[model samples]
Target chain A: MITQQDFEQIQDAIAGKLSADEQQAYNKRLSTDSNFAEDAFLQDKLKNILSDKPFDEFRGTLMRIETEYHYLGLWRTTETSETFSIEDILAMFEPVAHYEQALSHADLRAAGTALLQPQNGSNFLPNDTLTFAWAAALTEPLVLSIENNQEDVVLQDTIETGTVSHNITLPNLPAGRYYFKLTGNNSGMYIGMFFVNKNLLDEL
Target chain B: MVTLQQTQAFMNSKHTLNSNEQEKNTRIIDGFKNNNTRIIGECYAEMYPLIVRYITNNSGDETTAKEIIWECFEVFFKNCTKPDFVLNAKFSSYIHSIANNIWLKRLRDNKKYTYTDITITESSRHDFDDDTDNPYASDIDDYTDQITETIYENDLSHVIRQLLLELTEECKTIFRLKHEEEQSHEEIASLLQISIDMSKSRLYRCSIKMAQAIKNSPYYRELIDGFPFLTNYTNKKRKS
Candidate 1:
């Protein structure tokens, strides 16, 4: 059990406010009850701050960049091409876990870290994010013409399968931009259109 | 004297200083968004070492520390571009706190919670002068004397702030925003100009680095010396 004094010491240590010697003393106590060393209140306070920041406008915009190309000796530029689906796209996206809360506790236990990795597994909740594969499959790649745009954007890698989503980075995009049109298995086309924004990501 | 709530609110608020400091931060961030290499270089130069030191001290090794610090700032500037965002809290504290929390959450999620040697203490100051000789000395000389009290209070705050500043700008910003400002996600995004998702990711990364730093610190190990719960946890995981 943590005494109030020990708790106070833990706070002081974490705050980086303890004297060298005083820190030593507190360390001695912490060795005994390290669990109490954490202050959840402080953690929650910090978590909130980091979670509320803005999105990377640049990367977001770059992700939508479309390139024009000629295939099979035909001028089937990217802008006016028809939609198609790749197997890699289907395998890449994992369904969100459909957790039935009222079901047996065993089912919930099996759900385990799935709750944390909401992007993967079955779509238990509406907010659960689908994988990049799903995103690509649902919104098939938009083919455009070279004359329409000269931006140097390419599908860097085959969008990987599984539930994990990946982001690609593009640099030196000009200010003026436009939208992308998805073409594929016309079955469920026209899901959504993404606009290229002028926001840039911070250099890591 | 500021109340805890007031301090937390300041850290948490979407709007921070109405003074020149706000303008400076905004200008710096704008330079970053515009890729003004010169200005951004200066800011990164000032902030990077602090982040390195902070992450290295926590449980994270050099690579993890580097990633956390960079991500925190990357996320920061990403938000700085947003029109609605404003500066919030003392940037230093806000960053530090966020880094620390990220590391902690990682530990929890991994179920790899372990302890390292850390030292904790109660008192360190000693007075040698007789109670009467000093001109500005307090009339009383209790061990719990008011003069010593004042000294501790003043010195503690300064020392802690200095140490925290030694951490990366992101870590410091997170710590400050969380503890001093006590702002919410929407408020933080509005202040920093990043999206909520980016903010969460940054915070997680930074906090994980901080936890590792504290754990790696020798003093932290010392603190955990005799704690049975910690011993049990560590023994169960058994770090090689």
Candidate 2:
């Protein structure tokens, strides 16, 4: 059994955390002694451990960041301000897709809807796009503003799917951040916010 | 994410024993236990990735690798701070060695040992005492030459990354600090609120696991063939 003193001394030397004299002494003794094979083995192992990895395995760690959920949401009724957690709703959506194609194409809004209220209530919808309008409603409200060269002329159309699209025209509007507030005429209210660059639009 | 400086400071601090680091370890042996997360967290902050890399590099799935690594640390930490326990080596090497043993034993137990055409021998002998100043000088040169030749050919790194993804959050943290940050076991122990012995053991087991992982992998085997020191050494001392 190695003595604590010896072990500590050996460790200190190996770590290169030792004093000059101690280090020199360790070097001298190790050079001549075969019995110190254990120490040599330890050093060899340390070298193996510390040796520059010719292969960059550490880079693989970066991939983990993608797996984390950047956004989590609470679903809101399309008709009411009442809020409820969609966790149970999400849990019920089982066998929504194959194990590999887990990421649904739907955005957060769509994913939120699928997670909150599954269509069959039997299958788990993994698609991100499936959440759609209900998901947009669930996210806390955000204000969206569109700056145009002219504020008077507006293009508004309600798609047959009940989805509404608004195109406002403005002349000489400066480029800046904008917020929009969306309210459904029906019981379901949905809000979506995005940034618009008038300068870029003007060029087009 | 435990900084090296933070780990150093923790090594010098006296707050851990006063806290429940020991208490939690005790509970692990008896049943499920949760302790000071931040402290326990330090141990895993960097260790997780190392474990994953080791397993994945060798040839194991991430889930099995993560499970094995976690189990090794859990058992190691549970006994690390026992007043009677003493740390014998760098936590990194210790943890790696233990993990390697565990993985090797598993492979052996499962009868998965196959003669991969590389003949392992116990025939060659060297004269230099391993502890001497020039002990491994020749070996190093040979290993370096082999590695330098194959630097561009091996994809051992890709396999390692695939396995790393399977590790738990705790395991990743531990691996980062130990391997990437190069912190010592004592420092890691205090930062993680685990025993110094536990930290060392984890590192040892992690290394062993990784080595095994690499050895078991066909890609790693092909690469190691070009790595003279690793190949020659194993052929002489660790033949299958």
Tell how far residue B128 is off in model 2, in angstroms.
53
Q: Candidates' interface RMSDs, in order?
A: 13.9, 14.8
Worst 10 residues of 2 chain A by lDDT: A61-70
lDDT of 1 by residue, B1-240 (tens): 999999897544433343554575667767757755434444444444555566555555766765555544555554455576554433443344444444553444345665443321111111211123222222121222222222222222233333455689887786567555667657777788999766655655555555545446553443344223244333432221
* Per-model fnat list: 0.02, 0.02
CAPRI accuracy category, model 2: incorrect
TM-score of chain B of each: 0.39, 0.34
TM-score between candidate 2 and the true structure: 0.26
Candidate 1, superposed: residue stretches over 4 Å from native: A1-204, B1-18, B114-240
Cα lDDT tens digits for candidate 1, A1-204: 334444345445545678878866655544454454343222322333334333333332212221110111111222344221122122222121221222223222110111121221122222222223232222232222111023234223332223234333433222223222222333222111121221211000
Over the full model, what C-alpha lDDT does candidate 1 score relative to the true structure?
0.39
Q: Model 2: per-residue lDDT, tens digit, A1-204?
A: 334455556556546677777766666555555334333333344343444352122222212211111122212122333222223223322222321132332333321232233221121111212122332332232222321222222223232232222223333322322222233334232223222332222222
Task: Provide the overall lDDT of each model, using Cα atoms, as 2-decimal numbers.
Answer: 0.39, 0.40
Tens digits of per-residue lDDT for model 2, B102-202 = 56544544557843432322111121112233322222221222223222122333445555565566656667777557788788999999999887666
Candidate that would win on DockQ? 2
- The TM-score between candidate 1 and the true structure equals 0.25
